[model samples]
Target: MQKQETTRIKKEDKVKIIAGKDRGKIGKVIRVDKKKKRLLVEKANMIKRHVKPSAKNPQGGIIEGEGPIHWSNVMLICSSCVKPARIRMNILDSGEKVRVCSKCNENIDSK
Candidate 1:
């Protein structure tokens, strides 16, 4: 079995696209695929899906939505600084690991 890769980014985290067609775009991470090292960001990497007619949709047609982008293409946006910043894993005295913003040196995880 393939092991899941560790990622600094998490679901619901705001991120800025650094590389790709959506470069410089900022959006919230909707999902994280650790194994694929991809992220589904809100309003980024828009894609069109041709949906067939089904009970869920009476008139299925082209649906536009966010598509998965490579994790390396995005940078975490630091809440404290309100900018896309690098992150470092820090182990607290309580033995809990937390993500710290490289620019502001603030905890990324909310209390």
Candidate 2:
């Protein structure tokens, strides 16, 4: 199936995990992968990875890092409401588009 190229959750957006083991976790969006429909939330959904010793590192060990979570598993937190909320898109009279929070009707995106 073709994935949507644009996502409501953009870089630097605060989001709350709504499902899976990381449910209820809140974190900022570190990255957005539209092609894979996944988002890497900072300090959330952490996973351990084993890395081999390289020239940069004298020892190989396991490290914990944030893992990418599905877009569907997270909900954008409305700045106005300070809680997980849905997004609504609308155009202004000036012909500019804005993302609005469904719960508070506040413009979520400044740009």
Candidate 3:
């Protein structure tokens, strides 16, 4: 897939998992991989990894970490409504475009 120039989801944005095993779980966006079309959500999509003893992990047994979830599997939760909503862009009076929730028409981005 082609890399998107921009994404509606950003780090620290609160999001809700709409699909996959973690569906209905809500968490903050930890990071975004635009090229892979995935987002690392905090405490979602947990996966186990077996690692050998290393400097970083002396015990190096089984470890768990957040796995990337396809962006399509998640939706932004509107702050005002506290529910999942689709986002739309609109130009403000100052001509600055901002993301807003389609369900509530509230600003998704604080800026």
lDDT of each: 0.91, 0.89, 0.89
TM-score of 1: 0.91
Per-residue alpha-carbon lDDT of model 3 for 1-111, expressed as tens digits? 645455698889899999999999999999999899899999999999899999999988999999999998888888888888877889999999899999989887764
Pick the TM-score winner.
1
List model 1 lDDT by residue over 16-92, tens digit each: 99998999999999999988899999999999999998998879998899999988889999989999998888999
CA shift of 109, model 1, Å: 0.6
Candidate 1 runs further than 4 Å off: 1-5
lDDT of predicted model 2: 0.89
Candidates in order, TM-scores: namely 0.91, 0.88, 0.87
Candidate 1, residue 49: lDDT = 100
CA RMSD, predictions in order: 3.6, 2.8, 3.0
Quote the lDDT for 6 in model 3. Answer: 56
| Candidate 2: tens digits of C-alpha lDDT, residues 1-111 | 545455788899999999989899999999999899999999999999999988776697887899999998999999888989988888999999899999989999863
Lowest lDDT sum, 10 consecutive residues, model 3, at 1-10
